[model samples]
Target: MSTPALTLQGLGKSFGDVRALHDVDVTVESGTVHCVLGENGAGKSTLCNLVFGGYRPDAGRMLLGGNEFHPDSPAAAMAAGVAMVHQHFSLVTTMTVAENLLLTQHGLRMRRRDLTDRLDEIAQRYRLRVDLDQRVATMPVGARQKVEIVKALLREPSLILLDEPTGVLDPAEIDALIDTCRAVAADGTAVVLVTHKLGEVARVADAATVLRRGTVAGGGRMSKTSIAELLTAMVGRTAADLDPTVAATLGLDTAGPRAAARQRHSTALDATAPVLSVEGLCAERADGSTALAQARLAVRPGEIVGIAGVEGNGQSELVAILAGSASATGGTVTLDGTDITAARPATRTELGLGVVPEDRHRDGMVAGMTIAENLFLGQLGRFRRFGLLDRRAIGRAAQAELDRFDVRASGPWVRMGSLSGGNQQKVVLARELSATNLRCLVAAQPTRGLDIGAVDFVLTQLRRAATEGCGVLVVSSEVPELLALCDRVFVAYRGALTGPVETADLTAAQQISELMMGVAA
Candidate 1:
């Protein structure tokens, strides 16, 4: 048999005192798609980073094509026929797509024509059609992802690694990406897909490995194992015992929690008084072009509503207006009959409206700050006494929240950036849900990049909020996420809002997708 594309004997790495990865072993054969599955912070990224020479292994070794391989840097890894597409991209947004790819070929000093030819060749081969002249900053998340994939393929490496590649894609984009993975493997390149999406793992991978806290937990050939089994391995249990949200995500039965939640709180919500409402909302982009148009919606007390669409279909603009961080050129937004269209974020928070931002790191928390400081960001007045910040009081409250939210951290002193994606999300949820006067909540992509367990926690928290008489409005690209959590779902397309179809309605899903694609009924 031909030599395996990559073989890790006893790979290990550490970050200061934390054992990020232990003695781990995996083998990836050429001409096959191998999936590396794990929960966030379970060392999946660390292993891929080590393999791509983003970090040197603290112990053990790796082999590529039956040759001893220990790359000291990313460049060395590329030179040794290994390429990686990081979960968070490293491209320079100001540059054009062509420029970004050219940066990768700097050492080779290929002529402009040669670069174009190579890009065309790879693009055609993988069906990854991206506008080479388009500025990276202007492209959508899915396009940026395709650019990253193309950049890796341009290297023509024997092995390629992708970290959570589908986290930003819509269903159609995901299908196309999976096809590319198969094509790459068919050409004899080993493709290591590092992700927590067990469904995708089952759909695309030939073999799989599961990691939990830096060690192999369980895995097998894709044909031999099931998504349910891989999920059980990742989170340490069967689907039956998992939260309803988790079960719904895994395509297992949860008996429609949305309907159950409404039924449970029907008496309280019978008045059908909208806790949050928008009427003919119109918004503009920074360049003064229309971003949202004539949008209208309502969320009654104890109700969970959803907005679903492809990315960049005015979802961000709608979210910004709802979050009280952007202006609407016209129309009104009301919270319990109070007009708050021109309200500031702080004012909205104090007026009983909590918002979980789209990009948590950018909008919600300060990564460099301590958890205590981040937790009390908007409500610091609660601890300010006689012109002095009450550190001791903040610490106690932050610790209490940590415990309540089950946020795994080293007390409240740890930097917000140090937590995993899941934990950071938990902290965001804690900050918003802890308010004494939380009447309505607006969350954007609530479970976007979270793992199964984290997803379960976040959804449960939202349900609990609804259970306690708070209205919820969630914006997400995943249809499954919306169907699983919302009592009613809407579609946002070309800045127009359509449908508040009941998720429980027999043909609701078909209608939602049709509306999402701008279909008129």
Candidate 2:
């Protein structure tokens, strides 16, 4: 064929003792989407980094359009017609979108009006709309992502790499992004999509490559390769090898039967009084700006309620209010008919409230502490005997929790930081759900940055918690997860709520999407 747009042969990279990628090979043809599929630590990031000239490969070589490509820096990569949109944004938050985009060009003076005009033209041409005057810090996550994409598109690169671009976008935005990618590819630019989201792969990929533990697992043309095969390659196991519940959740098994069963569960939940209720809730951010206003929702016992929104739209503040970490400026929070608006976090916990904070590393655990210590962080008094801590009892209890939760770690004695992201999440889930009197759970982005198996596990746990009669409030940007797990879904936009849409409704996705954009009530 014509020279491949990009090629990697026996690519290998390492970080001291960790082999991030090994003998990895991939090829991207002109005007096509090449997907790099893998789990959290599966070297997908390393491979992309190598292509972007962020890290020099430890072995093998890369070719760009029949030429040897060894870029020493990102600037060199850009000059060679390669662009990358990183998972975490690289924009200067204090700068305006136009200013940030202008910085990408070399030898360009700081001319705001000229840059804004150029940006507007590029945005119009690419069907990517971004306000040139908007500060990066003030824009929502989806808007920021558009800015990133537009930044890349403005470069007019022959090859563009997008890393987990959909993680922060709503469904409508995701569809728009996919369309944008297709349009870009249609223009003869090769695209590399690095994502763990299977739906995205199925929708956009022309060719797919699976990476498992730093090695190529399997890959083929997207149309010919079944999702089951891709899943097997990613996890190193067949569908039958997965936990049946997880398999069912991932839709590897028929969902028709599961839907009927869940419908019954939902019906039962509908008959009960709300276990947790928030009315006219208002909250302020750390900067004293209104983060939540007149937000109201209720979660019945044995039900899962979802708060869906784009990031920076008061979802975080609402979760904080429920978790008792932030004060509500105007509104009431009630748990099982008892007012908890004025209660401290510890008191809320005592009153049967469990919270899984969004930033697990910062709020969920003490990284330096042992798993046992982190597991029993707040309730260490139970392990006290004769005025001294009972280490043996604590260890034993911790091990049981770890085993029960299926947290894959060396042992309970291992430091919390030593476990993977998934395992750390399990510790949080186990601690929260296993509370003796847990009546309500506030889980914020519970599966963020987790692998497929880990996501399945977390969802299973949340469903199990609901089945055990715990009212769950899941605050997430992931629409699929919300749709799959929540009995009723509510959309949060600009500190307001619109929805309580039944999951069984055929128009749920569209309705939710409209609400998410603050378009429909």
Candidate 3:
């Protein structure tokens, strides 16, 4: 029998009492895209962390080409012909693409021409185009992702791991990326794709392994298994008929009264006045470059309005302006008849504006602070007594929010960084939603790294918030998310709004996909 390119035998990892992975066995052959499918907490990330040298396994043996492999660090893994493209780009944004590419062990002071030539050669070979001289900061999300992939491929690795690579990409970008991954696999490099997107698995992965509750549930060649079969394996149940997988998890019948309830809610949201409105909004960078110009939008009360666009096309700027973190160069922003164009972030908070920022690691919570401290970050005024923060009161409040939001963590005292990506997002949601007077809620990429269950919970929460008279504006790069949650959807292109169309009107995923790509209806 031929040895697999990569193999994991009885792999197990634990964080104190939390068993992230338990006795997981999987194998990947060369020249194939082997996908790992699991819900958010199913140890898929833990397994990847161990394999990519981000974490040491508690017990297990990893084999590469019939040889024992134990990578002590990411560098060590790279040396052993293993490369990982993180879900988030790891490039230094201030640096040029060529510099970022050469920053690894491949760093060498080559002539500028030589660097560009090398980049061009690699990109052409992999069919992953990128501007070598362009600053990483100026690149689009798709292009930045290409840079990460190019950097990994430049190392000539035997195994490449991509974690949620398409999570932040639009539908068209996703299709392009899928093609790129398929091409990469054709070049004899074993690709390990970690994702929750079943459609992607069906499209690009040659084989898929399903993990559930820290153990391998089932796996087979992608061609042999139907999408429904894979879904069953991943969730431990048959969910073929459900629009989304939350039907069983939420304890609701898909073809029953619950479906009717959701449909009624989705319908009721179609005919309401916007809780938040923006017209002729424009935002500029410090360098005087326009990030958003003439952007107009509306979020109806008791409904979610999703703004879908490729990243760096003014989504960040829009969020910053709305959240009052940055001043809008030109525009009117109103929340229920109150003009807040010049309001500070604190003032916006006081005016019932709840903002869950896109960059969770940077803007959502302070990494150094405890979960409790992070939860109470902008809400200090609410817990203050005679100009002093009530520490005991804040702790109690934090604990309550943690429980209510279903944030899985050790305690309120644990560092925010110690929790998983999903839990961190939950912390952000808890902070923003707890503000009782919130009328306009802005959630940007609310569930970027969360599992299927968490996605459902977050979406459900947003809908519940909307049902209570607070308008919700969701800006996401993922089309399925927008299609699943929002009542009215808008396509953002070069900082321009294109829609206020009802979800029922854009029922087909292809319609939303076309609009996001700047296609006219």
Candidate 4:
């Protein structure tokens, strides 16, 4: 028989008494994507870690090209044709793209120019464009992730694993990565993708495996299985029970219960004066490139307005400037008629401006801290008694908020990083929305990596915020999300802004697609 790319037989793993995975079996063939699906603690990571040599299995064996295979470390695994790109990056912050890629292989010496040319060639073959001279620290999170994928592809591994790759990327970049994966798989490599997005699986995966509570639940060939069947297997719930918008995203027939619920809570919008407004707002990237130019928009009380565009087209810079992480070179931004263009983040917060950053872990909260501590960061005074923080008070309130947000965690004492992406986002939202004085919110890619349930909950929370008269400005890479949730949307392209176009008027999907790609009205 011809050898398969990889095969696992009855894999099992345990940490003390906690069985992370058991009797998990999967086979990957040459030139195909095999997706792993599950909720946060479904042993997807355990399986990926075992394959990449981050952990050793307590039971079962692996065969690589029909031969027994075992590796002691990640480096060893890479040497044996198993390459992995982690959800978090591993590139040096101070290095340039070329410098980082050149360091991929150790003890191999070559002229810098020659190696760069070869790297460029590989990147071109995959159609991934990287700014060779750009420093890692200066690039956006999405750009950095692209570089990591390219680094993994450069190794020419027979098996490649990508963990939650699309979380930080825009739609265009995600599409490009999917294309790249197909190209590599066509070259006879096996691709294992661990993802929460079913739509993406529909787009890229040839076959799938669903993990539930450390065991294989169900999965099948994409050509043979329906999306409804896949969703039911992964989540163990009927589509009718899901939020309308969530169901819509999964290509299911959707109802309007979520929207109807929001409507029940909503008061009439006061559009005479905006709670947040921007006029001719201009900003520059860290490298002095124009990031935003002549931007104009407004969010009325009890309204959610969104900005949609391809990544790297001023969205990040606009959010950064508004959040007070970066300075605007020109123009003005006002929160409730009070100019805040020069306000610090803390000052903005004090002025009732809450922000949910684009990359939640990196900018929204400290991962190493407990959820309670993270929730009250810079506001310990609320729970302070006699100049000491009241731990019991904080824990009680934090737990209540977590429960309200449907955050699945042991308790408020758990480390923020220990929670899944969706749960982390819930915690972030809990902190920001709980503020008694919150007047406006700026959410950047708020639902970036969450599962369907989490996305529904978060969007519901956003609607609830609007219902309570908190003006909202959402910056997103997905046009459909904006169209579904926002009252209106603005299209950004090449750092230029256009719109305030009502989603109701923008009925055709192609019209919005054209606008997103910078087509003239």
Candidate 5:
């Protein structure tokens, strides 16, 4: 009751036609961790942007420490003791850790030794031990996250807001981050965490606020609520009836129509055939340092294999190699028993290998292109009537997949960039899965940036593909999704695959946490 650290009353905002945030209210007490829970595009981002001065409130009032505060810009917000660590990192990669740490200091002139010393001091105080002299670009994702957290802490803000901070972190790194946040709260600083991870919400939040469709759905103190209860509220149903959550979080709960369609146990996949195989896969930088070393993997027909590890543990390299976008120095790749490692990405796609690339905006789809064009891009061969680009055929095909995949959008003619993040991901899924002759599917971070409902749709499609005898190899940092979806999970550490373990015998979350830190269990 010592006056809330921050308060919002009648909070509202909107884009031109979309009401991003409606008459919302939030309160953060001093020295407590407040968790804002929502699916992607549920107005969580809009709320934080308004608070951080990234956008002006269309209508609202903000009070910081019992005083009115409206920051015109991010710098002004920072100066007013409001700092936000965005979902995406904002550090300058070419700069050293110490340099990034000291970037915001005013007209600071100090020796390198003094800078390192200051960095070490901050690191020790906050329990974050980064390599002070190392460049930000070379650090792992976990370390880079620490750099951002430390940067915010160095300013000594009374309130810190983090937006989906753990989206890129593995299970182990997530635990460490939670510890750090708790330590910060113990120091009397209010922390606001925005995330969709219900487990994290239960673990760290003193109180939880649920948002749905730009409005507060429900909220309660964590001690008085459970993750299941919170999830039910955010989704607007009992946990038992949640089709999307069950399918996405636990791999098509054996009670839905899709699951009931499985009249009997399916036959095990053949262990002999290699729908997709890689041997001695090696990629090197121009400096002769290897990014991948002797990497080997195989995906058989009708199996979902997951690659699990901390971010930057060579997952990106593997994705690039398999996508046919990067050259292998000394490796052979075979698809459907034919060598195709040296082929261009388009050639690989022609050979029945579909890739749902890592970054949806950058690699998966052309943001500037219309949805119709992106959907029929590599499959032009299927629509070549009279040897001309068949607009009518493409439109029919794109519209079909869009409806099948439940992509909510203006139409097939709309630009991919205009869609929401969740819908954008659905677009990727639709294009990748629409190939009738696809022999193997390589999905990297397939459900990244997607909400629970969209995640369920994508996973269901993948499972149905597996049911229909298509091989699947999924790579994700999210353990629960992998645990629930993949038939087998493979541990990767420092560019090495630790082989696969059957999902029946292992929990995805625990195994992933162990693999991330190289622990034996």
Candidate 6:
């Protein structure tokens, strides 16, 4: 057989006391895609960084085409025919795509016209179409991802690493990206895909490896291994308890006959009366661009309603209007017959509105404060005693809330910024759900950056809150998440709401995908 494109032999890496990778080994043959599967904190990122020269391995060795390879920096890795596209993009927003591509080519000077021509030729040859003159800031999330892929390919690397590439893409864009990867792999380039989405694995991966707690759990050729075996290796559990319907969609067979019985039962909602009502909502951004236009929706008590769309298309504006952070230009918002259209954020909070914003670090909690302080931020009056503040009471309340949420931290006194992303989200959920007289809960992208376990916990909490008669609205770009949890889903396209389609009636993801593209299903 020809030499493997890349090989890792007993690679190990550590950060202080944490063993990020331990005795891990993987090999990728030429002209094939190798998928790395793991949950959050499962060492997937560390392994990718080790290969891309972001971190030096503490032990073992790496070989590139049977030659011992040690790269001291990303530049060295690039020079050695290896490239990585980070989860968080590294492109300059103000620069044009052509300039961004040229920025990486050191010691090479070419006229702007010549560079554009060369990039156009490469893009045409690879079928990766991109506007060379468009500014990165003006491009949508999907377009920016395509640009990143083009940049990686411009280097003519023998190996490329894509980290969680499909997290922000729509269905059509995801399919296009997968096609691009396949086309590149056909040219004898080794591709390493690090992802959590099982469906993508079944679609494109030639070989799969599962990493659990810094060790190689299991792996094999995709054609030879069963999905049940793969899931068992990644999650460290039998598939017996998983829902068969969801499992089958994810390309895995259910382990037991009772899998159908474990599916979440849909909650019934009253059709006539809505706890929260929004009609003809119109809003604009700071740049005077339309953010929302004529958006209308309703959520009944004890119901979980989902808003599905791509990254943009008025989701953010609607969430802001409901949370009282943004003013609506024209429309009416009512909360249980009370007009909250002109209400302040504090007033909305007083009226039993609990909002978990999309950016947890920016809008959910104050990172500089201690966990205790963040827990009781808006309800400090409850802990106040006599003419002075009650420190002991506040501490006790915060500790209780943290414990109730199962937030794993050093203590309540720990800084909120010091906790993990999942823990910070737990703090947000605990604060909002534990509030007194909570009539409505608005969760926007609640599980965006969380692990599998954290996502399961958050979804359960939302369901439990709905069961207790709180109106729940979940706005997310993830269709599978909405299908799994929401009682009914509303598609948002260009600020218009369409189809409060019952989850029971929705049989396939293509229906939702069509609606997301503003097309009738």
Best by TM-score: 1
For residue 412, model 5's alpha carbon misses the true position, in angstroms, by 2.7
Candidate 1, which segments miss by more than 4 Å at Cα?
253-268, 287-289
The per-prediction CA RMSD against the true structure, in angstroms, equals 1.8, 3.8, 3.5, 2.7, 3.6, 3.3
- For candidate 5, the lDDT comes to 0.79
Candidate 3 residue lDDT tens string, 1-521: 77799999999998888888989899999999999999877887778778889999888899988899998998888888899999777999999987787776354455567667777777676677777789988777778988888888777789999988977776667788888888888988899999987777878888999999899988889768776777777776666444352443222333442344357445675565667889999888877787887999887777778888777678888998998888887889998888999988888888889999988898888999999998887667788899898888988888899999999877798899888788888888888888878888999988776667677678778878987888899988766556556666787777777776556553445666776677862
lDDT of 2 at 103: 85
Among all windows of ten consecutive residues in candidate 5, which has the lowest summed lDDT? 257-266
Global lDDT of each candidate = 0.87, 0.84, 0.80, 0.83, 0.79, 0.82
Better of 1 and 2 by lDDT: 1
lDDT of 6 by residue, 216-309 (tens): 9998799899666777888866555554433433444423212222234333655548889999999987668887888889998988889998
Top-scoring candidate (lDDT): 1
Off by over 4 Å in 6: 243-272, 285-290, 365-374, 380-402, 413-421, 506-514
Ranking of models by lDDT = 1, 2, 4, 6, 3, 5
Per-residue lDDT of 298-393 in model 5, one digit per residue for the tens?
888888888887776678888888888878888889999889988888888878898888877778889899999888776677788788878888
Give per-residue lDDT, candidate 3, residue 151: 83
Superior by lDDT: candidate 1 or candidate 5: 1
Which residue pairs collide in model 4, if any?
Answer: none
Clashes of 5: 0
Residue 93 C-alpha lDDT in model 4: 87
